[model samples]
Target: MAVLSEEQSMLRDAARSWVQEKSPVTAFRKMRDSGVDVGYDADAWNEMAEMGWAGVIIPEEYGGSNFGYLSMGLILEETGRTLTASPLLASGLAAASALVLGGSDEQKSEWLPKIADGSVVATLAIDEGPHHRPEKVEARFEGGKITGRKTFVLEGMAANLLVVSAKGPDGIGLYLVRADDGGVKRQRLQLADSRGAANIELNGAAAEPLSGGFELVEKVLDRARAGVAAEMLGAATQAFETTLDYLKTRVQFGQVIGSFQALQHRAAKMFTDLELSRSAVEAALTAIDNDAPDVAELASLAKAKMGDTFHLVSNEMVQMHGGIGMTDAHDAGFYLKRARAAEAAFGNQAYHRDRYARLQGY
Candidate 1:
């Protein structure tokens, strides 16, 4: 486990308090029922922005605190506990990291302040298919214009800017494409998670390329994968705790189910896996913050471990709860659905496990 500094602890506590008081699982249910196209509460996002949550990874000169990636992960972990749906991960961490790491001064000056202030939402427009495949991009950039389709863009419909990937003459490159361009069209995706995601069609839209080539995509994606692992850690922890509480109280055969040896063993395994997963997650985030050369390896480790742990815990959350877990009225279903969506987001267990092996020269 990574040791938290005084400020890091404070940030985690503040994030925890805010999520519990302002945005809980109930809030998520309400958002789903209300059919909000943005997939989050606008007022709540503004509140987070005012608290500087959106600017955690952005440099101070760019209107952010530049606290670092680990700090942002802490906030993400807290928010994940309640299953809060927001663009914080997409715009705040993923999109912001692209700018912080590779954005030209002109690009930084034009977009970073708006991102930090919550005035604009941005997200990556990569992956042309249903699965995560950055290296297989068929989109091409020529003559300062990009034409292609991007699917499953997180917070896509709400974004004002898209950090797009395409085949440049120099090789694969990142482009800053405006959503408001006439050539751009968006189709909101109604996912099982009910989050804000879209499929985009860019028809010869003007784009400004970022400095880094394919290498930069890999770097930006590492940050994204690590952040997702942090959020998964928070959700998995909560699921285990909630299930453990249910075990302690619910009676089966005239005794608390906690007395059952089989259930006790299952819970114990989950606790152990969660602890190990936390170590991997914190290590990955810390690696990014420290600019470690082995970041890709750690990222794969973190995401794969977190994916397996979350998949196990979420399945057990439903199985352990018995009947209530299967119903829409219970929050177990929410966790289960979220697990499926998040597991597939950046890379699933199979994907990351393969990546990890390849990185290790297997």
Candidate 2:
């Protein structure tokens, strides 16, 4: 029911066109064939930076475009359509959220401009394991030195700056640590999606404490969850569209499988699921912008629903495409792989659903 403004629509359309032209399925195939782990194209990343995609949600004073979260979501959706590989989710959204919510003036002045310009890659290191419970953080900071291990850090191997979550004397705090710090070590994790991540080992790594306390960390997590939900929605939307296109073109025994009643019904159901997921994602974005009291709950709900939607839609997309969907040669498989990875990226469906239920006092 929510309508984007004219400018917003234009921005979304422009991103879509750029992705289609520059970062198409052929590019993904090439990356996969070359055994590239991250699947990122440097030229495409620069193009995105030039188009202000990196600064969509950053404030104006920070050299960003200052568009807001909705615009960021729109761009994410377009990126999903192509399965374009980049650190947009980790650097552009997660790191930016942390900086906006908790960084000091000096921290902001030092990092935000570089991030807005895409000159630096950053990511948040919070999950110490497969289970993402920040409150259970065991990473320790003592005397301005951090020592701990963080697992499953998205884009961890590539980030220039890491906003690390640690247990301070008072409570949880965000610490800014440069990746090149002497005591820091990063081990690349070979994930199923071909996206880059790592396990970071910190042994007395020098860190600058962020300004806020646990409350600010919680707020940043909320924003990060909302941003991830938006990205999941993008993946889900792309999966549905990809399946729809395949159904229309691929012939069956006599005609296009899309014309069959059963296939049509399945497509309709997938579309419905996609729209429902979109509504939840949009609600989360609005809650974030307005600082709604239920923002956390809405974010969990959106993430949970979109996680389920992505799984169902991506699986269906593959099934509808038959054997070709399982082969790496087809674009459908790429979307499926990305969707499965993203479903578990920030939090899986059951994880967020339980969080949502707890938030609702269930």
Candidate 3:
């Protein structure tokens, strides 16, 4: 396990307690059943902002705590543990990442404060293809207007502002567009985990250009992957923990299944996998914090490893739970569904594996 500083440890503890008490797994089920348009509770988001989580990575001058990305990752891990559904990652973290890396003074002055206060819901619209392909951004930007379609945009259904990527005369550029602008259209997607997403089509939408453009887009993408990897780590750990609890109490063939040698071995393997994933995610977050030269490669490595590990752990959780696990009434299945969604979020294990190899020049 990675050693945490006093502050990060406290943040993790506080986040875990808050999620458990205020918005546990049951809250997610309620939201899904409620058939709400946003698919998340507004009260929970405000509570998170009140807790200073919304500004965990933003600069203090801009109404943020400026604690950095590692601090943000700690909070994400806690949220992932309970399958808490919120735009904290999609809007708060990912959108904030783009602004922090690329936003000019005027842009930051106007948007950061609102983002920090949870008043403005923002998201990234980078992938312009049917899948996760940053290189496939073919959206057009001409004469200060954007025109193209982006798919699988996280939190796109509920965003008021969008950080869109388009091919400009210079190169791939990042442009900010108002979600309700005249030329924007969105179609909500039904994800496996019920986390909200959308396909957006932009037609001659006016935009404000971020300073760093493509370079900043790369940085933001790596940071987003690292954040998602941390969340996956938490979910995998939780699933393993839940399965362990079930094994201890569940009876099988006149004995507790956990007491059996075969079952004990499976538990041990899961524990080891979870620990390995923890190490990779922690390394990636630390690399980003220090501005390490190899941060990009580390992010890809962590994402691939964590996604695969979570897929493994979540599957085992369902299997170990036996028949009850297959039923919708059981929470074990939720973890598996969430794992599937997250695994495919930024990129799946296969996508990142290829990315890691390319980064290594293999």
Candidate 4:
């Protein structure tokens, strides 16, 4: 088990209480029904910035807390419990990770402060295909401009700055591109979880190169996978807890279903999976914080284990709840939808499983 310091515990507790009180699952329903252009609530995001969560992983020089990735993961876990949609993971962690690892001194000096203050929204646009493939980048950058289409960009529609990957003359390179520049187009995608995503087309859009290329991109992805795995851990655990409550109180054949041996066994399985996922996510977060040599493999392990567990727990959530679980009126279905979308983010269980094996030289 991972040990938490007093501050970390306090941070986790405060985030849990705030998310449950201010932005629960019902908040997501309201956002969806409102037909808003943005998928998340802006004021809620500002509240998070006030909490200093947006700068959790950044250095203090840039107005950040320099608390590290584990702290950020804890906050994300709390938000994920209630399915709170925000760019915390996309911009706060992922984009910031890329900039911290690859950005030049000037680059970091320019953008990190804005990211720390929640003044700018950013995203990493890497994959050009249906899935996560850092090495398969075909988008071209030449003459201080990028030209090509990037798909499945997280928070792409809302991000003002994009850390993009393309095949440069030297090799695959990372560049910062402005979304508002000429020849830039964004088409928002409607995802299962209703979290914002988009396909971005850059035609001669102005760009500035970041220091690291493919190597840094891969590292940034590992960090992203770990963060998402933490979120999945929280969501799966919440679903399991809610379902367990139902099983205890819900009656069948003139008795509480908790007394039935079959239902008991299913609940036991969910509990086991949820606990295992928690362990895996915790280990991954620690690995990142320590800059462990095997962080990449650990990240892949966390992503695969947590993603599969969430899928199982969510499916079982609906099955155990009966027909009402399938309806939009029930919150159980939303958990499943979020689980599917999260499982597909960064990489699915199958993709991460393969990556893990390769990392282990299997």
Q: Candidate 2: what lDDT?
A: 0.84
Clashes of each: 0, 0, 0, 0
The local lDDT score (0 to 100) that residue 182 gets in candidate 2 is 98
For model 3, state the Cα shift of residue 316 in Å.
0.6
| lDDT (Cα, tens digit) per residue for candidate 1, span 1-362 | 68989999999999999999999999999999999998888888999999999999999998999889999999999998999998999999999999988898988998999999999999998899989988999999999999999999999989999999999998997999999999899999999989999999999999999988999999999999999999999999999999999999999889999999999999999999999999999999999999999999999899999999999999999999999999999999889888899999888899999999999999
TM-scores, all models, native as reference: 0.99, 0.96, 0.98, 0.98
What are the root-mean-square deviations of the candidates from the true structure over C-alphas?
A: 0.7, 1.5, 1.0, 0.9
* Model 4 per-residue lDDT tens digits across residues 107-141: 89999889888989888898889988778887899
How displaced is residue 330 in candidate 1, in Å? 0.5
**Per-residue lDDT value at 142 in model 1:** 96
Off by over 4 Å in 2: 37-39
Tens digits of per-residue lDDT, candidate 2, 1-362, equal 35888988999899889989998768866765676545476677888888888888788899898787878888887787777788888888889988988888888989988998889989989889887777878899999999999998998887999999998898889999999999899998887777778999999999998878787777777777777777777777877887888889989799998999998998999889888988988988888877789988888888888888888888898899899888876777777777777877777788888888888889
lDDT of candidates 1 onward, in order: 0.94, 0.84, 0.89, 0.90
Clashing residue pairs in candidate 1 are: none
Give the number of the best model, judged by lDDT. 1
- Model 1 alpha-carbon drift over 4 Å, by segment: none
